[model samples]
Target: MGNINKRGSKDLVVDSDQSQQDSPTITVDNQLCDAIIKEDCSTIKALLRSHPVNQPLTILTSYRLLFEQQTCTVIPIHLAAEYCKPRSLLCLLEHGADPEVRDTQGHTTLHLMLLHWPIVSSTWTKPGNRIQRLMADIQNNAVSCLHILFQHGAQVNAQVGNSNKYSPLHLAITYGTHPILSLLAQNGAQVNAVNESSMTPLHMAADILNENMIKTLIACGANVNCVIPHNGNTALKLAVCTASSKAGQLLSAGVGCIRLLLIHGAHVNAQDHEGQTALHEACCGGREAIINLLLEFEANVNILTKNGESAIYMYLQRSSNIRDLMVLTRLLYCSYPLRLTNRQGVLPAGIMLPEFQLLKETLVRLARKPLPLEDICKKNIRNIYGKKYKYYVRQLLPGKLWNSIYNCYDLADVLKGDL
Candidate 1:
């Protein structure tokens, strides 16, 4: 009986010590919590100096003492954010709390701030809801917190482990926080890093159509042609597939990037897993300027994909841009014995319904245009100036314009069949 009592006493002392150690340092939690709740600085400073490495799990528990008992282990920054104390939050971050520390639910300080600040601010009814405060925090010291995490080797490339796997850089871009993205990139974030869906920062930039971000990424040497691992879609491919403003910006940037890729020896004939080339993308985008440029680089006009669709077919099917239509016609007529069959074994002309019959007929007229007198000329001099000049004139001026000189008639009236 005496031995058992002694053993029980020792066990009780061990439990007590464990309890004391498990408790957050009371003085530190009280002082910091007071600062955070009251927006006090001196108390926060004294508390920081005393226990510079103190954590906030206890004061948060005290808040549960104030409210009902709920699991509350958020850090001081998160608490500051909760109380709408931006200045105090900044102080805590400056003092050495880990911003990237995950809560029990795995939310970081930024995530907490992003999630809760607006809610707390919204309860005030009508003073503008602390938007400027939150934006300022995010723009200034919060970005520094993000940078600090990066400096200490945090992963900007980390996805949220959801289906989307959006990285920090992806979030910054999505939120239009340009400064954060720039900081992340400067801190060695992968500009072209992909998410679980195999979408790179370039893909996000293109999807969002942030022209400045896109240009910045391109300038930073993002692989413009980096294909998504899952679908084999390039940044250019994704850009063209959308009807959003981003598509316009990418098309406006034109073949400069595309030309850069091609000049650097990007496979002009490289097909997506779907078997579409950059030319096909440009045509489908109805970007006349880019289509012209791609053709100049000799992008495969008749290159069939696994589905057997040619660039011309995609242009006719997806676009109403007159320039794309003209360029497609030129590509088809200029090719050697052009075939109209797409990847699906559907001829572009035969597949035409009422929507595209006019276009199809127009293309047929262009394809059936007569060869020039120069091709028939035997002499070198005639050959130089004859058929070539005829082709040039026909290409440069419409049939009506040429007929005004040839038939001595009113070009507009005659072309409209009025005469």
Candidate 2:
């Protein structure tokens, strides 16, 4: 019995020794992957050297998607880029990890880098000087990683095979800085590439009211008049609608973004599927600055939606506050027809503010009067030139004197500067 017990003890000791010998080999790959995700540069270099240089390390990420097994196999470069680690990413690239390698989910190194963009972009809103600097550093590191990948022949326009089929440029526009956008643009990304929604980068920019992005995209050759297939809404119309929302009001980028679109020749009279123009949207939302800006850009004051409601009628129907009357005044100043009946068959005068009761008769009489010859000539000239109206007007007058004299035909200060 004693001899049998000694043999069993010896067997147990050998099993324990064997287990110790197998553990490091079993875990070394996982350790390397963890070191990479943690951005441990030196440890990554050390572990990488232990493996065959010809064989790249891969991360086998396992997850459950409904009833299926969604196993994703990604390389060290993708992990490095995903974590925004520039140094480790450069290390992987130098060790011959292909920058164009796509994971099972079809995310290239660049896509992984961009996946973290929103967090970095939104860090500016966090309140702290140290936090701001840290965010800047993180952003710079991510940019540097992209530069390294581009140096290794990464494709700038590769579309993620996800359902949305978003190109790198589309992702960049989601929450990108100007420098990163310029980098992608310079690297041959198609500025007008549309996603599954037929939304160009410009559409995203305008929807978010990103004035700087709109300017950059225009410079990069984005078609200002590109329309969405789903809604037939151009970027200009989309900006107007979005700006009328509470999110839009808070950012206050609506007027500036719309102005940029107009300056770049977005058709002011462009209509959406609803037959509503940007002016109609502004009026419905009671956006005063947008209404005036639209007027300056020659948005047709007489244009009616498919519903048979004029912009003026829409304004009166949804007028919320007393400040909304300011928009109404601008609409009238731009010659919005008071005679046009809404779908409700009511005249704009029928809904006049109580304050306007004193001037109601005068306003009704004025609408009945035809435009004078002086106004007629100006209208004809403006209609003839259309987009070039301001350019010709500037050349004809040749000074600030033109703006003062032609206040009736003047563009906004934003568009006027370009003139």
RMSD of 2: 12.0
Output the TM-score of candidate 1.
0.59
RMSD vs true structure, all candidates: 13.0, 12.0
Clashing pairs in 1: 307-343, 308-342, 308-343, 309-343, 374-387
Residue 5, candidate 1: C-alpha displacement in angstroms: 61
Cα lDDT tens digits for candidate 2, 43-71: 87888778643344533333323433222
lDDT of 1 at 293: 60
Which sections of candidate 2 miss by over 4 Å?
1-26, 34-74, 118-133, 321-323, 336-339, 342-419
Which pairs clash in the backbone of model 2?
A: none
Error of 2 at 233 (Å): 1.6
Where model 1 places Cα greater than 4 Å from the true spot, the runs are 1-34, 37-39, 45-73, 79-96, 110-138, 147-157, 243-269, 285-290, 296-298, 318-325, 349-351, 354-419
Q: Return the TM-score for each candidate structure.
A: 0.59, 0.71
Candidate 1 lDDT at 251 equals: 48
